[model samples]
Target: MEDPKRLEEGLGHENKDRNEQFSEKDDKTKGGDGINHEKEETNTVVVVEQKGDHKQLQQQPLVKQKTKRVATLDAFRGLTVALMILVDNAGEAYPRIDHSPWNGCTLADFVMPFFLFIVGVAIALAFKRIPKKRDAVKKIIIRTLKLLFWGILLQGGYSHAPGDLSYGVNMKFIRWCGILQRIALVYMFVALIETLIIKQRQSVVEPNHFTVFTAYQWQWIGGFVAFLIYMITTYALYVPDWSFDVYSHHKLERYMVKCGMRGHLGPACNAVGYVDREVWGINHLYQSPVWSRLKACTLSSPGSGPLREDAPSWCRAPFEPEGLLSTISAILSGTIGVHYGHVLIHFKDHSERLKQWVSMGFGLLIIAIILHFTDAIPINKQLYSFSYVCFTAGAAGIVFSGFYLLIDVWGLRTPFLFLEWIGMNAMLVYVMAAQGIFEGFINGWYYKSPDNTLVYWIQEHVFIKVWHSERLGTLLYVIFAQITFWAVVAGILHRLGIYWKL
Candidate 1:
């Protein structure tokens, strides 16, 4: 049998030789492992084989370097980010493009989780390059802190407006947690376990003696344990202080109602607040008075209610998707992503098997069925319910696999370049959007002409007048607006080569 190491070394040498030839001449080469060159000096072409020990070549840095990023994965990530921006900025004109209120899924619901899954995939690729366990843990912690800080900043930090600090907290007041913050926390914990625990165990277990069940078996068990703990901690077991008193015959609902007179009714109803405050306490929920005061200053306005309302009714509360408990499930979703990344790495070129796709398809089917039938695990973003996590994960897996197949396997590329460009600079675009750089200009249209705001003009003229279909027209309008914004962003980033990294 031919040695795999020797073959890899020989391939690297051939690549190096080709590069050397190309540098020597001002021309380019084409084709596979063998090099065919055409010289600009003469219209002649030449083929050459440089003989050397492929084993020695294998030890070179080029041969031993990690795999190049698969473009399909980046494209998939870009598509996910684009969807996030569109859904986030749908401007109330297109309800269907928005996420489901509670206990349901929508096209918009899949975006954030897909980004999280991609984060897991990126983490898997990253850890391979950082060999030291302690060093990896330190790096993960630093990254997590940075993400948490940024999440808080985006949540409110640096003031909702410039030169405004009269609010309770510096800008981090509404510093409850967020999408990137959740991702950071999950990545930190997962990296710690994978490095300190899983890798250590694997090292002790000899490769030849290992079965899949024995070697990588801990991760599945760990996932289930985490899920079980989260469910029990969040739902099945409740703190006595927050529960109805059987002896006193006072229902919890009645208690909340009695307390409603203290400005606790309607939007101020503290049923959800009581649970988050009394049950989980401030540690997990992190609801400081300063944060509440900051929220009152920054988010108490008319149009911001829907987006800023954290604690609704108790029934609706846990389903907030971004709530404290739901984050546990989201962390588990990240674990699921990590496991999928492992499969991608270990299987590599063999991922095209019929069984693999079939298994993934079945996983998605099961999630869909559960999402349709089960009411206990609501598909609410606030609660981040187990069902919601499963549903989003399944959808994300399907999308990732599809992208991998199309871009990596089939070598197809096309109109997605704009998306790819923005994706490479996603954080920058998000921050820029948040800072009102584009919103300022977009909203400026409304200032000039009362009916000329982009959304208003589209609703009145494009949807109502030009097109008959309100929903479809409005949806298209949103897409057009998003694409226009993306084009501007892409042009700027392309010009400066300014890709933001965290």
Candidate 2:
């Protein structure tokens, strides 16, 4: 009987020897003691063989036909969604959890990019299991539209109807750009690229379950081209001289006359903002985009539409950070994720896979740092700046790599079940939380009166009293309640055997 170690050997070498080593009968039957695992949960699978009466283990594929998800990706996604809920809820309590006022990355800023990256990785994995479905394009288009519809319906920053069940859907002043809208558009674009242009390089006849798309030369070509497109478009388009003076129209005109940037091609005067304003109209843009306010003008509150036309000159009109043009960069973030996905599924050696992630992750990070310091590109989330995506994607790569090493390589799954539960039903939680389902359904009871709100009451009595600070208590409660509440809900959902997608 062959040693079991052969079953766990590198797929590349073992597969190479299969034709000469095994007879035709070897391929025909499973025989005894040679059952193969269908789950591609780890980097390797143990294949077994039979010779005469002696059943023996032999080389196996790293992944099987089904390609069940690697637990690490689920953990990564869960952690990302969990943090998103935390920061979104914490905005009122902790200033640090809030997004940077204008041009820098924050813990909050990292969430969107990482999620986009996860989408890319998931795309690679999903396609491997079921490529070229009869309704593939139809499914892609439908999914894309659903995401877009939900984005506009729930997060479009439209006002509600007065004393009516129907939403206002106010066309006169509805914001077109939003978190989910950006996600939908990005996903559609990437999926189209995968389905039509990139073209999967797989071996259909051989039927090696472990084999995934190499993408090879095309991967680098796609990435480089995406970068070029973003950089050129970011800089080449013309933008008007922005007015900083909110009140004195005459002063603004005068300042525009002499300001060096007025006629210059600056980022503040780029094509992205100009096009968005024209298409969506200033009144239809995000009201609370991270922008500078001056001359006693206050920032617009969340969910508000664009500034009034009559607003003082100092009140900056909203410009979407996730605007149309920056979406190209967003797609690039997903592209990088696809590359990592290739490494994960195609590369069988754990060390080789780790090396690839480290190189890709650090390479992007270093390039981002260089571009930022050299002013080749700025790290601005508002613009979805080129450098910003590079940095975020880099961090995401390193993070997932670490999780894969721990959970998949070291076989540590039980420790992260809490995160796994949340991850499996991430989209459900996100949409529900975004639409005020949590607050409307659950918090309504808690906040009916001062006595009923357990979280606030506890904070007021315990954390505040012990810490001797109201703000500190509120911050602590914000972190604790969000994580705990969601984890419990996710746990129950997991136990109920429900998985939500799209």
Candidate 3:
């Protein structure tokens, strides 16, 4: 009979030595036929080969572990939020720090748009983690509703302590629309487009070689559409008759007159208050009785000390900074932020060359040039001009990219810990500061020494006394009060482990 070992050895040179060894072992244990043992051994070899193949199949890509530090993005967001708090709560907004009046760009102008943009970046990051389409849609709806509800609450749901509105004829209508409300509206619309519309379309296609362009192509298209729609709406409202000279028509002024005539004169007898009447169209659209009731109250109090009727309506124009038309530009600003986040995530592995930085810098420079020429697209925060959007977005992108490089790429984090800490609980600080939660505690009531009560002394003596000659100093004093308030609030929030989420 042919030897089983010899037959196995003839299969391959490598197998010959392995087969001889196995045969020797089998002979020592000889409780069965050699051919039966050889067959069992061969089956074991096949099983081992299959197990090895399975291990290789289960291995994940190297990139999975490497790309997990999304903390950098969160840190970037925190920095932006911190800057917002700083600017919003400046000790003294010297011309150097404050935004330009209406025509030019400034550091202050970048804060709001940067916040919105960061929101967009967050939106992009969020949709990826959610499991089902229905759940995502539900989350989007809930978030939008909560934002709107809180926005309205902040405007004046609790403007007066419970029964304060009951005082003989004291009714104040807090302006209906505001920053948070606008953010809610825009976010809702964007989320709807991204989740329900865009994702549905993407699901129908083949899975393997999915392109980012096809998936998020709608964001770009939608951004453009938003810009165009806003621009057209603003143009029509600003110059209803369609005259070449935008100044000739003054559609806003005309609208104000129409609003005033309708007896919906709003809070103060000023242009901004009047414009609120037009935008809210509260009487017509929502059937809001607040405007009409307030008007009646004012008329009833004919002899009351100068019932706000004589206040120059134009004075309200400055208050227009937070208004309807401007919100359009704000939404566009968020879109720009979304674009930046996309680039950062997608090109993380690309060469970190000087050319990439320079290219971004140049792109911003080009935008600045275009803004300089297009005076028609005024850089007005109140109007939310297209030029304002371009200038703010460009500046914000440069700042964000610089911070990303320094903190994330270069690993320089320790130096910015305090700022980062303050940033982490930013919204908490803002609400606390805005609500005067710590004003009495920090604003000099606790000080034993007369001179040590810096805030009190400044407000009563230096600000009201020594600086009495300059109006600017008084404004600066208010800013100083705001800053001191924030510092105390930041310290407290840091200690409490309280981080406010939106």
**Number of the top lDDT candidate:** 2
Off by over 4 Å in 2: 1-69, 129-134, 158-169, 197-223, 241-268, 293-315, 443-468
lDDT of 3 by residue, 335-387 (tens): 76665544443443323322343355457657765766765444655456667
Error of 2 at 473 (Å): 2.7
Query: What TM-score goes with each of the models?
Result: 0.66, 0.74, 0.61
Question: Which rank order by lDDT, best down to worst?
Answer: 2, 1, 3
Which of candidates 2 and 3 reaches a greater lDDT? Answer: 2
TM-score: the better of candidates 1 and 3: 1
lDDT of 1 by residue, 6-53 (tens): 001011122433322111121222111011112222223343445774
Candidate 1 clash total?
11
Quick one: best TM-score, which candidate? 2
Over the full model, what C-alpha lDDT does candidate 3 score relative to the true structure? 0.47
Instruction: Evaluate residue 383 in candidate 3 and report its C-alpha lDDT on the 0 to 100 scale.
Output: 55
lDDT of 2 by residue, 1-502 (tens): 1101111111222233331121111121110112111222223455667788888766555532232235676688878887787677666566566676555577888988988898777665444433344355677777778778777876675423111223566676687777778888877777656555434555231223223334444544666687778777666655655432222455543223122222222234656676687777766767555543311234343322355555444245456767887787788888888777666656666787788888779988998899888877767777777789889999999999899888777767788877766677777666655344454444344554634654446667867887888767766765565555666787787677555656
